[model samples]
Target chain A: MTAALEARGLRREFGHVRALDGADFDIEPGEVVALIGDNGAGKSTLVKALSGSLAIDSGELYSDGKRVTIDSPAAARALGIETVYQDLALAPHLDPVQNMYLGREVMRSGLLGKLGFMDHAEMKEKTQRAFADLGATVRDFTAPVGAMSGGQRQQIAVARAAAWASRVIFLDEPTAALGVVQTRNVLDLIRRVRDRGIAVVLISHSMPHVIEVADRIQVLRLGRRVATYDAKQTSMEELVGAMTGAISQEEAA
Target chain B: MTTATEPDRDAAAVDEEKPKSTLQRLVGAQAFQILGVLLILIVLFSIAEPDAFLSINNFRNVVVNVSILAIIGVGMTFVIITGGIDLSVGSVLVFSGVVAAKTMEALGGQGVGVSIVGALAACGSGTLWGLFNGVVVARLKVPPLIVTLGTLGMALGAAQILTGGIDLRGAPTVLTDTIGFGRLFGQIPYLSLIALAVIVIGAVILHRTRFGRYTYAVGSNDEAARRVGVRADRHLILVYTLAGFCAGLAGILNLAFFSSTTIAGQSNTALNVIAGVVIGGTSLFGGIGTIAGTVIGLFIPAVLQNGFVIMGVQPFWQQVVVGAFLIAAVYVDQVRRAAASRGASTRRSLFSRFSRPQGARRKEAQ
Candidate 1:
């Protein structure tokens, strides 16, 4: 099957540092591909390129074998790409329902809705259902997100992307600041998203988490794809070696 | 597997939930506090001057007097809600009033229909200036305060240039007398009624519509709103334009009520409107506020000024008292925000604490 998203020869430079250097990555439908790398491994750069947050100097992106151009974040969203950045980018003072329906609010069906009135009930119900499907509990539906715990806030961010994204969802360091329970919740949420048939690109620094959730793992070393491994087939030692440039693919085999 | 301590633990859980509800309930309770203050002021004034303060005519006078400021307050609410300040509202108001008076004069200001056309021109002029401010602020990426300040000077200067530093007089009698002083159904002053209608519409737009949702979202975090495919730039422009439209509406009201452009040094006008919005519980930091709160905020000053005048207090004291309330309102908001955040942290710690196992579970948890 053709991959849902494919990027080849993606190159970006910040002054002299080639943040992304000829990096190639792809994710198939119904796939949870964890993009892993060390501190400066260009994992985030590649995600930004695919999500249309950053401009690339040279690259070819293919969506289901059809090459496409993503010049802006809006363009990327138009092509069904949604990103949950590390910051989560949520309005702190808004409630879960409001945050979930932030940009793409559901309008009422009649004249009032046509005149830009919101369907608050539908938006709330949908948000509640999304949280329910993820098995996540938002203790107070009306509380501002700033008042939510790190994990609950993370869930809202993921749930928001899940609600709107049809093809690809990129989560950039979703659990970097979350505690153990919250991390598990997010990982479980990611798995459920994959089961929903939307491809998920999880960027993380945690090796165990990458192995625990990712069906396919792609390692980036200094702005280049170093190795790819199946979660069931690969060992942690090999994954670490691939990330740190200590072992080559020949030796890993 | 209910332990002997299960019931007690459930009680503990309920006890723990007490603070969370308190935090969520702050918004409703805060509105009540403002209302209480308003009530106390009204009662004290009514008791002090039973004949004057309690009279229906005096009450109507206060309402009509506040109508102009209230109209401007509506637009300022939108501007401030988006985490922006429009220092040009006063200038914009004067400019639109002048434009209306000029339009009426040129169109043979004789009938009510001609006055209506002039009012439309005033609104258009105000919206045009507001759109200009929006473009300079949004497209050019200039700060709102600076852009509005620039427009503030330009608008007032243009108004002065139009009438040669004189207030334009001779507006159509329909505007000054018929709509200005005439009662609606022989009860409500038309000017005051229009202001009330504007407030109702503003409330519905701010509280019940997608535009209001976006306004709050943009105020809270414009970048986040943009990331979610909201054309935040366009929204900012629209918001400023709305604010300008309100200023225009206020200008029309001023023209009718005062029977002229009434242009002068209006530096205090913007400050008063902004003060009212902030006092109403709309945060200066943005993303949190309500229309009802703004009405109360504006009314406090109106009541104080009217009551103080009746009770033989100086007019300057009104400013001092209103200024104090502005600071007090913001301080209360800050305290509530701090407590809410504290509640969130406490809840988080409690969740982790309860989830952690006796001793062995803790070690194996992460």
Candidate 2:
């Protein structure tokens, strides 16, 4: 099967620091691929580059085997890519429904739509359906997402990306701040999203979670992809060794 | 583990379906609370001067006088909702009125044609100033307060230079006669009617339109809005420009009502409108406010001044009262924001429920 998203020789630099040095990545359609790295390992830089939030120094990206350039978040979105950053990127003052449809609001029909009036009822209904489908417990649709608990906010951020992203969704440390139950819920949500035939790229530091939800694991060290392993076939020790530079696939080969 | 989470999920579902109580709903509504305050003040003033303050003529005069401020307050509400301040509004108003009055004088006509030209000149000048402010604040990345403050001085200075320190008079007899004092059916002043229309339209746009949602989103979190593909910079510029447009509109209204540019009359206008917007429950921190709240807030000071005059209290006391109210309103906003950030429901009083300690709120994963 063709990879839903593919990148080759991705390199980004910030003055003296090379954040991404000739990194390569690919994820098959409908698969959960976890991108693991130590601190300053270029996980976020790679994700940002792929999601069109940050410009890279050099790279080539392929979407469904076709070359594409994503220079802005909007461009990435148009190419059916969505990202949930570590910050969640939600307007704290807006409610869940409003947040879900922030830039892409559902407008009223005819004259009202032309005048930029949003169809609140339709947006509300759609948001409700999305939350229900994800089994996300977001009570009080009227309350601002900032006023919600961390877990609920996480669900909102994830659900928002899942609803709009038709091809691939990139989640950066989605479960970092979540509790055990919320983490499980998010893992289940990822599975359901994959079951819908969309690729999911998860960036996480937690090895056990990487092992549990990921079908394949890719490790980055010193801003380069050091190893790739079938999640079920690789041991946690080996993954940690790859991340810490104790085990280099290049040297082993 | 499944059983442990089941009851929690069920409880959340139940909570979602539970209907809000009347008191709860009332407390949640900031506008309603402000309206109540306005009504209580009205009652007190009426009781104090049954013959003077309670009369229709007094009410009509008060409303007519506040109509210009109300028009400008509509724009201020929008600006504040985006976490921005436009101190240049009063200056923009003065400058626009000067330009409009000059245009009407040069046209040398008291006909409706002259009035139309004068109104356009006013709106055009105001829009230019607004666009300038927008470009500076949005694109150049200057803080709104400083940019508007600089423009405030510049705009007022430009008006002074254009007129050479004298207020321009003679605003076309047609404008002053018809739009200034003309009453609808011999009761409502034309100025008040125009202001009312602006208020209604402004309210609808802010509450029911995508433009308004973008305003809130940009104010709430600029970076977040941008990340979601919102053109935040463009939106900020638009919002500031809208404010300038409103001030310009108010400038024409001011000229019609006063029959002069009133260059020196609007120095306190920006502060007064900002006070009223805050009193109406619009947060200075942005991302929350309403036109209705601003109307009620504008009335609080207007009514206070009108009441004190009739009640034999010095009307200067109105400033003191308004100043105190502004601080009180902001304090309430801060407290509410604190509670909200803590994930507490703002419907109840802060001390009503004992919140869990911060560390305890985050449970460990099993």
Candidate 3:
């Protein structure tokens, strides 16, 4: 299958340190690709470049075999690329429905919408359905997300991406701050998102989670794609060895 | 995860309770706290001085007295909700007032017609100043507090220069008699009516429109807003400009009500308006508030001042009481924030402490 997203020769430098050095990566439609690496492996840098949150010093990004430039988060979103960041993804003061439709509001038709009035009921119903479909129970739709459990907040963040992401979704350590149960919920949610035919790129430090959900594993070491493995065939020891440079791919082969 | 399970019946009972309805939730909201306080204050004052404090004349007096402050406080609510401050509102009010007075004086003093023209001029000038502030803070990326502080001095200095430090009086009696003291159907003062209209309109714009959502979003988390394609800079500009326009309206009201621009030590007006907004429970940190709360907040000070004067208490004591209330309001806000975060964590701990349910475990094991 043709890859939905591909990045070639991604290079970014921060004066003395090279954050990203010619990283090459790709993800296919309906595939879960876990981008894993040790600290300073440039996993975050590559994710930022792909999500249009940062500019690579040199790189080529392609969507469906066509060259594309994502200059800003909005540009990435226009191409159906959405990201659930580590934090600051939702306004704490707003409700789930409000947070879900923050920028992409549905306006009421005729004079009311022309006057900039939001169709709140419609948005709320859709947001409720999205949460239910994701198997997440949001007890209070009116309470501020800040007042909700961390897992519920994560669910809203993921559901927001699922609703808008048509081409690719980047989840950046989505469960880093969550508990084990919440992490499991997020992993299950990821599988559901993948089953819906959208490409998912998960940036995670949890090895078990990466192994459990990812269809393909892409390991980055020192700002470059060191290896890609089929999840069913690869071993955690081999992946960790590639990340820490303990064993060479040639030796493993 | 199974090792962490705690079979607590109380926790299960807590989980089985039904969620609150919209009305029930609203009644318990942070914004309604001041409404209760206001009602209590009204009861106490009426008992203390029945003839004076509860009289119709005193009621109209207090309402009219707070109209200008309430008008400016409405805009301040929006600004504070967006995590910004506009210190120049008072100076802008004076500048716009002066502009209205001068425009009327220069327009042959033809009563209400010329006064209308002068009001438009005042609003336009105030809006321009607000737009300047918005552009400086949004496009140039200067901090809002500093940008507004600088404009404050400039606006006040311009007003002083325009009038040579002298109060401008004597425009037209019709302007004062109709707009200043006029009543709507002989029941409500025009000023009070205008303030009511502004409050109603402001509430709609804030709670019903897309612009209102952007205001809360930008204030709560600006980076998140930008990430979601909200033009934060543009929203900032719109917020500042709306504030300026409100100040301008307040300026015209000042001109009409007083028939003069008193440039003597009016710098504290902005602080008073901000105090009212804060007292209404709009967080200084941003992303929370209601126009109704602000109206109640403005009335608190107005009622206290009026009641004190009638009860033979010193006027200075009003300031002390208002200052105390402002601190109390903010303290309550901080307390609520702490409770909210704690509530979230406690719920999560309960969920995790219980581990997976039996049905989920069977599915997972399979």
Candidate 4:
């Protein structure tokens, strides 16, 4: 089967620092692939390149085995790719319905739509459905998202991605600030997203989470993919060793 | 993976039991509270001067006097909601009126045709200034306060140079007859009617449209808006331009009502409008406000001045009172923001019993 998304030889530089040095990545359709690394290991840079948020000096991207170029976030979105950045990227002052339909508001029918009027009813109904489908419990439909709990916000971010993303969704440390219950919800959310037949790229530091939700794990070290392992077969110690550059699968081979 | 469990039943039950009564909602609105303050002032003034302050004529005069400021306030509301300020509105109004008055004079007719051209000239000039403000603030990322301040000086200076420090007079007689003073059913001033139309349209656009939503989103979190594919820069530019457009419209209205450009007047225009917008409940921090709040905010001062004059109080006291109101409004906003950040409900503690359900309390405890 064609990979949902594949990146080849991606390179990015910030003055003297080469953030993404010849990084390669691949994820099959409907698979949950965890990208793990220590600080400054280029995991984020690689995701940025693929998501079209960062410029890649040199790289080849393929969506569904077809060569493509994604120069902007809009372009990546056009290819059915979405990213939940660490910041959650939610307009806190807006309610979930507003934030969910921020750029892509559903316009009212006829002349009103032409006049730029939004159909709040339609948007609200759809947003409600999306949350219900994701099993995310949002208490107030009218309150600003900023007033919500961290877990609720995380669910919003993830559910928003799941609603729009058809090909792949990239999540950056989705559970970083979440508590135990919230973390469970997010992990369950990831599985639900994967079940929808969309590829999920989870970037996380938690080895247990990676092993739990990810079908495969890709380890990055020094701006490059250093190891790929079957998550079910891999040990946390081995994954840590690969991330910290203490183990080389190539050398072992 | 385990199937998604239901949300806590207590929380769900509490959410379903929320009060849906109109009175409950009205009491919760920021605008309603400001309106209450306005009503109290009106009542006090009436009690003090039943014959003068309580008359229909006095109310008409007050509304008519504020019509131009109301128009400008609508635009200011949009700007402030976008996390920006436009200090050049007063100057821009002067500049646009000058241009419109000049256009009508050159056309040399008191006919409706001349009025049409003059109105367009005013709106066009205002749009240009707005466009300029938008470009500088959005493209160059200059702080809006400084940028508008710079334009305030530049626009006023430019107006002075164009007219040689003299106010332009001679708006078309037809415009001054119809739009300026003409009223429906001989009761409402045409100026107030026009102001009403502008306010209604502004409210609708701000509350019901995608553009308005983007305005709030941009103010709330610009980076988030950008990430979601909103051209935040373009939107900011549009918002500033809209403010300019309103000022321009106000300029034409000013000419109609005053029969002159009033270039030397309006020194307090921008400040008064900004204060009214804030007093009405729109935040300086952006992301939260309403046109209703701004309308009430503008009225607080207008009514104070009108009522004070009839009550034999020095009208200058209106300024002091309005200043107090502005500070109080902002203080209230800050307190509410502090509560919201702390995850407490925005409703006052008295109303919190009705608003926050048991589920919310349990969640907070956790």
**lDDT preference between candidates 3 and 4, better one:** 4
Candidate 3: tens digits of C-alpha lDDT, residues B1-366: 455333222222223334668786666555676777788888888898999889888899999999999999988899999999999999999999899888888887566688888889889888989999999999999999999999999999999999998989855788788778999889799998898899999999999999999999999989889888899999999999999999999988888898888677469999999989998889898888888888888888888888889888998899999999999888777766764564331222212325755345324322
DockQ of each: 0.44, 0.52, 0.47, 0.45
lDDT of 1 by residue, B54-119 (tens): 999999988988888988888888888899999999999999999998888888947988888999
Question: What value of lDDT does candidate 4 attain over all alpha carbons?
Answer: 0.88
Off by over 4 Å in 1: A233-236, A250-253, B1-29, B339-366
Instruction: Report the C-alpha displacement of residue B53, candidate 3, in angstroms.
Output: 1.7
Model 4: per-residue Cα lDDT over A44-115, one tens digit each? 889989999888999899999899999999999999999999999999889999999989999989999999
TM-score of each: 0.90, 0.93, 0.93, 0.93
On a 0 to 100 scale, what is the lDDT of residue B245 in model 2?
A: 91
Model 4: residue B134 alpha-carbon error in angstroms: 0.7
Q: What is the TM-score of chain B alone in each candidate?
A: 0.87, 0.91, 0.89, 0.90
The CAPRI category of model 2 is medium
Candidate 1: residue pairs that collide:
none
Off by over 4 Å in 4: A251-253, B1-26, B347-366
TM accuracy, model 2: 0.93
Task: Categorize the docking of model 3.
Answer: acceptable
**Residue pairs clashing, model 4:** none
Candidate closer to the true structure by lDDT (higher is better), 1 or 4: 4
DockQ of 4: 0.45
Write candidate 1's Cα lDDT for A28-74 as tens digits.
99999999889899988898899998999998999989999998998
